[model samples]
Target: MIREPDGSIKIYVRDNRHPQVIERQLRNLDVRADVTFLPPGKDCREPRGTYLPDNPALLTSEPPAEGKDDYWRLHPEQIKPGQTFVYTMWYEEHGDNRMFTARYRVATGPVAPCEVVPGGPVMKEGPEGGIGD
Candidate 1:
Protein backbone atom coordinates (compact mmCIF):
# COMPACT_ATOMS: atom_id res chain seq x y z
CA MET A 1 0.00 0.00 0.00
CA ILE A 2 2.63 2.56 -0.61
CA ARG A 3 2.23 4.50 -3.84
CA GLU A 4 4.87 6.28 -5.88
CA PRO A 5 4.73 8.75 -8.76
CA ASP A 6 1.98 11.22 -7.81
CA GLY A 7 -0.79 9.48 -5.88
CA SER A 8 -0.76 8.42 -2.22
CA ILE A 9 -0.90 4.92 -0.72
CA LYS A 10 -4.01 3.09 0.47
CA ILE A 11 -4.31 0.52 3.29
CA TYR A 12 -7.41 -1.53 4.01
CA VAL A 13 -7.70 -4.25 6.62
CA ARG A 14 -10.41 -6.14 8.47
CA ASP A 15 -8.97 -5.08 11.84
CA ASN A 16 -5.51 -3.84 12.74
CA ARG A 17 -4.21 -1.11 15.04
CA HIS A 18 -0.49 -0.96 14.53
CA PRO A 19 0.80 0.60 11.36
CA GLN A 20 3.19 -2.30 11.03
CA VAL A 21 0.24 -4.40 9.87
CA ILE A 22 0.77 -3.02 6.38
CA GLU A 23 4.39 -4.09 6.33
CA ARG A 24 3.42 -7.49 7.60
CA GLN A 25 0.72 -7.94 4.99
CA LEU A 26 3.02 -6.78 2.24
CA ARG A 27 5.67 -9.26 3.32
CA ASN A 28 3.33 -12.12 4.16
CA LEU A 29 0.96 -11.89 1.21
CA ASP A 30 3.47 -10.30 -1.10
CA VAL A 31 1.12 -7.40 -1.88
CA ARG A 32 2.73 -5.76 -4.85
CA ALA A 33 1.07 -2.60 -6.13
CA ASP A 34 2.74 0.64 -7.08
CA VAL A 35 0.76 3.54 -5.64
CA THR A 36 0.32 6.50 -7.96
CA PHE A 37 -2.53 8.57 -6.46
CA LEU A 38 -4.78 8.95 -3.46
CA PRO A 39 -7.42 6.25 -3.76
CA PRO A 40 -10.56 8.43 -3.91
CA GLY A 41 -12.09 9.61 -0.60
CA LYS A 42 -8.85 8.62 1.13
CA ASP A 43 -6.61 11.63 0.57
CA CYS A 44 -6.80 14.29 3.23
CA ARG A 45 -5.27 17.48 4.56
CA GLU A 46 -4.15 16.08 7.89
CA PRO A 47 -0.62 16.04 9.22
CA ARG A 48 -0.46 12.26 9.59
CA GLY A 49 -1.93 9.63 7.22
CA THR A 50 -5.17 8.25 8.69
CA TYR A 51 -8.90 8.63 8.29
CA LEU A 52 -11.90 8.88 10.67
CA PRO A 53 -14.76 10.10 8.55
CA ASP A 54 -17.37 9.43 11.23
CA ASN A 55 -16.00 12.21 13.45
CA PRO A 56 -16.33 15.40 11.51
CA ALA A 57 -14.83 17.38 14.39
CA LEU A 58 -11.85 15.07 14.41
CA LEU A 59 -11.11 15.18 10.66
CA THR A 60 -12.12 16.85 7.46
CA SER A 61 -13.90 15.44 4.44
CA GLU A 62 -11.64 13.47 2.11
CA PRO A 63 -12.03 12.94 -1.60
CA PRO A 64 -13.06 9.52 -2.86
CA ALA A 65 -10.74 7.23 -4.82
CA GLU A 66 -9.74 8.74 -8.13
CA GLY A 67 -7.70 7.89 -11.19
CA LYS A 68 -4.73 9.70 -12.68
CA ASP A 69 -6.47 13.06 -12.26
CA ASP A 70 -5.53 13.02 -8.60
CA TYR A 71 -1.88 12.77 -9.52
CA TRP A 72 0.36 15.63 -8.40
CA ARG A 73 1.65 17.17 -11.55
CA LEU A 74 5.36 18.04 -11.63
CA HIS A 75 7.38 19.92 -14.20
CA PRO A 76 11.07 19.90 -15.09
CA GLU A 77 11.68 23.35 -13.67
CA GLN A 78 10.07 22.43 -10.37
CA ILE A 79 12.63 19.74 -9.60
CA LYS A 80 15.70 20.80 -7.65
CA PRO A 81 18.71 19.19 -6.01
CA GLY A 82 18.73 17.51 -2.59
CA GLN A 83 15.14 16.29 -2.54
CA THR A 84 14.36 13.20 -0.49
CA PHE A 85 10.80 11.98 -0.03
CA VAL A 86 9.46 10.08 2.96
CA TYR A 87 5.80 9.03 3.19
CA THR A 88 4.10 7.26 6.09
CA MET A 89 0.74 5.46 6.40
CA TRP A 90 -1.34 4.27 9.35
CA TYR A 91 -4.38 1.97 9.68
CA GLU A 92 -6.84 1.58 12.54
CA GLU A 93 -9.66 -0.89 13.09
CA HIS A 94 -12.91 -0.42 11.14
CA GLY A 95 -11.57 2.62 9.34
CA ASP A 96 -10.00 3.58 6.02
CA ASN A 97 -6.39 4.74 5.76
CA ARG A 98 -4.15 6.60 3.34
CA MET A 99 -0.53 7.62 2.91
CA PHE A 100 0.73 10.66 4.76
CA THR A 101 2.51 11.86 1.66
CA ALA A 102 3.66 10.74 -1.75
CA ARG A 103 7.31 9.76 -1.88
CA TYR A 104 9.50 11.05 -4.74
CA ARG A 105 13.10 10.46 -5.73
CA VAL A 106 15.52 12.79 -7.49
CA ALA A 107 16.91 10.26 -9.88
CA THR A 108 19.98 11.18 -11.90
CA GLY A 109 18.87 11.53 -15.50
CA PRO A 110 19.08 13.88 -18.51
CA VAL A 111 19.21 16.84 -16.11
CA ALA A 112 15.67 17.96 -16.81
CA PRO A 113 12.40 17.02 -15.11
CA CYS A 114 9.54 16.83 -17.57
CA GLU A 115 6.48 15.54 -15.76
CA VAL A 116 4.24 18.39 -16.95
CA VAL A 117 5.83 19.56 -20.17
CA PRO A 118 3.17 17.68 -22.15
CA GLY A 119 5.14 16.77 -25.32
CA GLY A 120 8.88 16.50 -26.00
CA PRO A 121 11.20 13.63 -25.10
CA VAL A 122 12.93 13.85 -21.73
CA MET A 123 16.25 12.37 -20.71
CA LYS A 124 16.25 8.96 -19.08
CA GLU A 125 18.61 6.28 -17.77
CA GLY A 126 19.58 3.84 -20.51
CA PRO A 127 21.79 0.79 -20.73
CA GLU A 128 24.73 3.06 -21.69
CA GLY A 129 24.45 6.81 -21.66
CA GLY A 130 21.51 7.84 -23.93
CA ILE A 131 20.11 6.09 -27.02
CA GLY A 132 22.64 5.87 -29.87
CA ASP A 133 25.45 8.44 -30.29
Candidate 2:
Protein backbone atom coordinates (compact mmCIF):
# COMPACT_ATOMS: atom_id res chain seq x y z
CA MET A 1 0.00 0.00 0.00
CA ILE A 2 1.32 3.43 -1.00
CA ARG A 3 0.04 6.68 0.40
CA GLU A 4 -0.16 9.32 -2.27
CA PRO A 5 0.52 13.02 -1.84
CA ASP A 6 -3.18 13.65 -2.44
CA GLY A 7 -3.97 11.65 0.71
CA SER A 8 -5.23 8.68 -1.21
CA ILE A 9 -4.11 5.09 -0.77
CA LYS A 10 -3.03 2.83 -3.58
CA ILE A 11 -3.26 -0.90 -2.97
CA TYR A 12 -1.74 -3.43 -5.32
CA VAL A 13 -2.91 -6.98 -4.85
CA ARG A 14 -0.97 -9.63 -6.71
CA ASP A 15 -2.51 -12.63 -5.01
CA ASN A 16 -6.16 -13.43 -4.47
CA ARG A 17 -5.51 -15.67 -1.48
CA HIS A 18 -5.47 -14.74 2.23
CA PRO A 19 -8.38 -12.35 2.15
CA GLN A 20 -8.77 -12.43 5.93
CA VAL A 21 -5.22 -11.23 6.35
CA ILE A 22 -5.83 -8.41 3.89
CA GLU A 23 -8.94 -7.33 5.75
CA ARG A 24 -7.02 -7.25 8.99
CA GLN A 25 -4.28 -5.16 7.45
CA LEU A 26 -6.77 -2.67 6.07
CA ARG A 27 -8.44 -2.41 9.43
CA ASN A 28 -5.10 -1.56 11.00
CA LEU A 29 -4.91 1.35 8.60
CA ASP A 30 -8.30 2.62 9.80
CA VAL A 31 -9.97 1.40 6.65
CA ARG A 32 -12.85 -0.93 7.26
CA ALA A 33 -12.80 -3.57 4.59
CA ASP A 34 -14.39 -6.96 4.05
CA VAL A 35 -12.33 -9.00 1.64
CA THR A 36 -13.32 -12.27 0.01
CA PHE A 37 -11.47 -14.44 -2.45
CA LEU A 38 -13.83 -16.68 -4.33
CA PRO A 39 -12.93 -19.85 -6.13
CA PRO A 40 -12.93 -20.00 -9.90
CA GLY A 41 -16.42 -20.11 -11.46
CA LYS A 42 -18.05 -19.16 -8.15
CA ASP A 43 -19.46 -15.86 -6.93
CA CYS A 44 -21.29 -14.31 -4.04
CA ARG A 45 -25.01 -13.57 -4.12
CA GLU A 46 -26.04 -9.95 -4.69
CA PRO A 47 -27.19 -7.53 -2.00
CA ARG A 48 -24.56 -8.76 0.43
CA GLY A 49 -25.24 -5.63 2.42
CA THR A 50 -26.77 -2.17 2.13
CA TYR A 51 -24.50 -1.03 -0.67
CA LEU A 52 -23.81 2.57 -1.56
CA PRO A 53 -24.08 3.93 -5.06
CA ASP A 54 -21.05 3.63 -7.25
CA ASN A 55 -18.53 6.44 -6.78
CA PRO A 56 -15.63 6.40 -9.17
CA ALA A 57 -14.07 9.49 -7.64
CA LEU A 58 -13.68 7.73 -4.34
CA LEU A 59 -12.28 4.54 -5.79
CA THR A 60 -10.54 3.92 -9.06
CA SER A 61 -7.96 1.59 -10.59
CA GLU A 62 -5.18 1.67 -13.13
CA PRO A 63 -3.85 -1.23 -15.12
CA PRO A 64 -0.24 -2.26 -14.74
CA ALA A 65 2.28 -0.41 -16.85
CA GLU A 66 5.70 -1.54 -18.02
CA GLY A 67 7.25 -1.45 -14.58
CA LYS A 68 4.28 -0.69 -12.38
CA ASP A 69 1.79 -2.95 -10.68
CA ASP A 70 -1.98 -2.77 -10.96
CA TYR A 71 -3.44 -0.87 -8.09
CA TRP A 72 -6.66 0.60 -6.75
CA ARG A 73 -6.67 4.22 -5.63
CA LEU A 74 -8.96 4.84 -2.68
CA HIS A 75 -9.71 8.27 -1.31
CA PRO A 76 -10.57 7.51 2.27
CA GLU A 77 -11.46 11.13 2.93
CA GLN A 78 -14.50 10.69 0.71
CA ILE A 79 -15.69 7.70 2.69
CA LYS A 80 -18.20 8.42 5.39
CA PRO A 81 -18.20 6.88 8.83
CA GLY A 82 -19.99 3.54 9.37
CA GLN A 83 -19.24 2.60 5.81
CA THR A 84 -17.27 -0.53 4.95
CA PHE A 85 -15.46 -1.30 1.75
CA VAL A 86 -16.00 -4.75 0.29
CA TYR A 87 -13.53 -6.36 -2.08
CA THR A 88 -14.03 -9.60 -3.98
CA MET A 89 -11.57 -11.28 -6.32
CA TRP A 90 -11.42 -14.44 -8.40
CA TYR A 91 -9.60 -16.06 -11.27
CA GLU A 92 -10.90 -17.55 -14.51
CA GLU A 93 -9.15 -19.82 -16.93
CA HIS A 94 -9.85 -20.09 -20.64
CA GLY A 95 -7.77 -22.63 -22.53
CA ASP A 96 -4.21 -21.50 -21.80
CA ASN A 97 -5.13 -17.99 -20.72
CA ARG A 98 -5.93 -16.97 -17.17
CA MET A 99 -7.83 -13.86 -16.16
CA PHE A 100 -8.11 -12.13 -12.83
CA THR A 101 -11.24 -10.30 -11.82
CA ALA A 102 -12.00 -8.05 -8.89
CA ARG A 103 -14.99 -6.06 -7.67
CA TYR A 104 -15.41 -3.29 -5.10
CA ARG A 105 -18.49 -2.36 -3.10
CA VAL A 106 -19.30 -0.02 -0.26
CA ALA A 107 -21.88 -1.01 2.34
CA THR A 108 -23.34 0.88 5.23
CA GLY A 109 -24.12 -2.13 7.44
CA PRO A 110 -22.89 -5.56 8.20
CA VAL A 111 -21.60 -7.52 5.25
CA ALA A 112 -22.85 -11.01 4.50
CA PRO A 113 -20.62 -14.01 4.15
CA CYS A 114 -19.68 -14.99 0.61
CA GLU A 115 -22.20 -17.69 -0.07
CA VAL A 116 -20.46 -19.38 -2.96
CA VAL A 117 -22.64 -20.10 -6.00
CA PRO A 118 -22.19 -20.80 -9.67
CA GLY A 119 -21.73 -17.72 -11.83
CA GLY A 120 -24.27 -16.73 -14.44
CA PRO A 121 -23.84 -17.34 -18.12
CA VAL A 122 -22.17 -14.81 -20.42
CA MET A 123 -24.62 -13.27 -22.90
CA LYS A 124 -23.61 -12.24 -26.41
CA GLU A 125 -25.84 -10.30 -28.79
CA GLY A 126 -25.46 -10.37 -32.54
CA PRO A 127 -26.54 -7.89 -35.20
CA GLU A 128 -29.65 -9.97 -35.89
CA GLY A 129 -31.03 -9.29 -32.42
CA GLY A 130 -33.94 -6.82 -32.23
CA ILE A 131 -34.70 -4.20 -29.62
CA GLY A 132 -37.81 -6.09 -28.44
CA ASP A 133 -36.38 -9.50 -29.07
Candidate 3:
Protein backbone atom coordinates (compact mmCIF):
# COMPACT_ATOMS: atom_id res chain seq x y z
CA MET A 1 0.00 0.00 0.00
CA ILE A 2 1.26 3.53 -0.81
CA ARG A 3 0.12 6.48 1.25
CA GLU A 4 -0.33 9.75 -0.59
CA PRO A 5 0.44 13.25 0.65
CA ASP A 6 -3.31 13.93 0.82
CA GLY A 7 -3.76 10.69 2.81
CA SER A 8 -4.96 8.09 0.28
CA ILE A 9 -3.88 4.50 -0.23
CA LYS A 10 -2.74 2.54 -3.29
CA ILE A 11 -2.49 -1.23 -3.20
CA TYR A 12 -0.35 -3.53 -5.38
CA VAL A 13 -0.73 -7.28 -5.52
CA ARG A 14 1.61 -9.21 -7.85
CA ASP A 15 0.96 -12.59 -9.38
CA ASN A 16 4.00 -14.81 -9.06
CA ARG A 17 2.07 -17.70 -10.57
CA HIS A 18 -1.05 -17.98 -12.76
CA PRO A 19 -4.08 -15.81 -13.45
CA GLN A 20 -6.50 -15.17 -10.58
CA VAL A 21 -9.47 -13.11 -9.36
CA ILE A 22 -9.75 -10.80 -6.37
CA GLU A 23 -12.30 -8.74 -4.51
CA ARG A 24 -11.46 -5.45 -2.85
CA GLN A 25 -13.08 -5.47 0.60
CA LEU A 26 -12.91 -1.97 2.04
CA ARG A 27 -14.91 -0.11 4.67
CA ASN A 28 -15.48 3.41 6.04
CA LEU A 29 -16.16 5.90 3.21
CA ASP A 30 -16.61 5.28 -0.47
CA VAL A 31 -13.60 5.73 -2.78
CA ARG A 32 -12.57 6.31 -6.38
CA ALA A 33 -10.18 3.76 -7.83
CA ASP A 34 -8.18 2.46 -10.78
CA VAL A 35 -7.26 -1.17 -11.42
CA THR A 36 -4.61 -2.51 -13.80
CA PHE A 37 -2.85 -5.67 -14.90
CA LEU A 38 0.85 -5.42 -15.67
CA PRO A 39 2.52 -7.82 -18.07
CA PRO A 40 4.96 -10.51 -17.06
CA GLY A 41 8.69 -9.93 -16.38
CA LYS A 42 7.82 -6.51 -15.06
CA ASP A 43 9.27 -5.32 -11.75
CA CYS A 44 7.17 -3.67 -9.01
CA ARG A 45 8.26 -2.99 -5.46
CA GLU A 46 5.59 -3.96 -2.95
CA PRO A 47 4.62 -0.90 -0.87
CA ARG A 48 3.87 -2.95 2.25
CA GLY A 49 1.12 -0.41 3.01
CA THR A 50 3.39 2.55 3.55
CA TYR A 51 5.41 5.09 1.56
CA LEU A 52 6.09 5.48 -2.14
CA PRO A 53 9.72 5.45 -3.14
CA ASP A 54 11.33 7.14 -6.15
CA ASN A 55 10.83 3.97 -8.21
CA PRO A 56 7.16 3.04 -8.26
CA ALA A 57 5.47 0.30 -10.32
CA LEU A 58 5.21 0.58 -14.09
CA LEU A 59 1.50 0.73 -14.94
CA THR A 60 -0.67 1.07 -18.03
CA SER A 61 -1.28 4.57 -19.36
CA GLU A 62 -5.01 4.43 -18.53
CA PRO A 63 -5.99 3.46 -15.00
CA PRO A 64 -9.52 1.89 -14.63
CA ALA A 65 -11.18 4.68 -12.67
CA GLU A 66 -10.22 8.32 -12.45
CA GLY A 67 -13.03 8.95 -9.89
CA LYS A 68 -13.97 7.54 -6.46
CA ASP A 69 -16.17 4.56 -5.58
CA ASP A 70 -16.88 2.05 -2.84
CA TYR A 71 -15.11 -1.03 -4.26
CA TRP A 72 -13.80 -2.86 -7.36
CA ARG A 73 -13.81 -6.49 -8.41
CA LEU A 74 -11.07 -7.85 -10.69
CA HIS A 75 -10.98 -11.10 -12.67
CA PRO A 76 -8.04 -11.45 -15.00
CA GLU A 77 -7.95 -14.53 -17.22
CA GLN A 78 -4.25 -14.46 -17.99
CA ILE A 79 -2.23 -12.64 -15.37
CA LYS A 80 0.82 -14.73 -16.39
CA PRO A 81 3.50 -15.35 -13.81
CA GLY A 82 5.44 -12.24 -12.78
CA GLN A 83 2.58 -9.95 -13.73
CA THR A 84 0.89 -7.64 -11.21
CA PHE A 85 -2.51 -6.20 -10.30
CA VAL A 86 -2.85 -2.72 -8.88
CA TYR A 87 -5.54 -0.65 -7.14
CA THR A 88 -5.28 3.06 -6.33
CA MET A 89 -7.92 4.44 -3.99
CA TRP A 90 -8.64 6.75 -1.08
CA TYR A 91 -7.42 5.89 2.42
CA GLU A 92 -9.90 8.12 4.30
CA GLU A 93 -7.77 8.83 7.32
CA HIS A 94 -9.44 10.20 10.42
CA GLY A 95 -8.23 13.18 12.45
CA ASP A 96 -4.76 12.02 13.60
CA ASN A 97 -6.14 8.67 14.74
CA ARG A 98 -6.84 5.73 12.43
CA MET A 99 -5.91 2.08 12.53
CA PHE A 100 -5.10 0.32 9.24
CA THR A 101 -4.72 -3.38 8.70
CA ALA A 102 -4.64 -6.04 5.96
CA ARG A 103 -4.83 -9.80 5.47
CA TYR A 104 -4.62 -11.83 2.23
CA ARG A 105 -5.17 -15.42 1.08
CA VAL A 106 -3.87 -16.93 -2.20
CA ALA A 107 -4.59 -20.12 -4.15
CA THR A 108 -3.35 -21.34 -7.54
CA GLY A 109 -2.90 -24.71 -9.25
CA PRO A 110 -3.94 -26.79 -12.33
CA VAL A 111 -7.08 -28.18 -10.73
CA ALA A 112 -10.68 -27.12 -11.52
CA PRO A 113 -10.76 -25.01 -8.34
CA CYS A 114 -7.91 -23.47 -6.41
CA GLU A 115 -7.23 -24.57 -2.87
CA VAL A 116 -6.90 -22.27 0.09
CA VAL A 117 -3.53 -21.81 1.74
CA PRO A 118 -3.45 -22.13 5.50
CA GLY A 119 -3.61 -18.96 7.53
CA GLY A 120 -0.45 -17.56 9.10
CA PRO A 121 0.21 -15.64 12.28
CA VAL A 122 -1.33 -12.20 12.66
CA MET A 123 0.94 -9.21 12.24
CA LYS A 124 2.54 -7.98 15.43
CA GLU A 125 2.29 -4.29 16.30
CA GLY A 126 5.34 -2.10 15.95
CA PRO A 127 6.94 -0.44 18.94
CA GLU A 128 5.43 2.88 17.92
CA GLY A 129 2.18 1.22 16.78
CA GLY A 130 2.78 2.45 13.26
CA ILE A 131 2.63 0.39 10.07
CA GLY A 132 6.12 -0.93 9.36
CA ASP A 133 8.00 -4.10 8.56
Q: Which lDDT values do the candidates have, in the order given?
A: 0.29, 0.73, 0.29
Q: Model 2, 3-38: lDDT tens per residue? A: 779888877755445888778767777889888877
Return the TM-score for candidate 3, rounded to 2 decimals.
0.20
User: After superposing candidate 3, which stretches have Cα over 4 Å from the reference?
Assistant: 1-57, 60-114, 119-122
The deviation in Å at residue 34 for candidate 1 is 14
Question: What TM-score goes with each of the models?
Answer: 0.20, 0.76, 0.20
Tens digit of per-residue lDDT, candidate 3, span 1-133: 3334544344333321122222232122122122322322222233323322322222222243655422223333223333333342212123443322222212122212212233322233367755332
RMSD of 3: 14.1
Off by over 4 Å in 1: 1-10, 13-17, 31-99, 104-133
- Worst lDDT run of 10 residues, candidate 3, spans 105-114
Who wins the TM-score comparison? 2
Q: How does candidate 2 score on lDDT?
A: 0.73
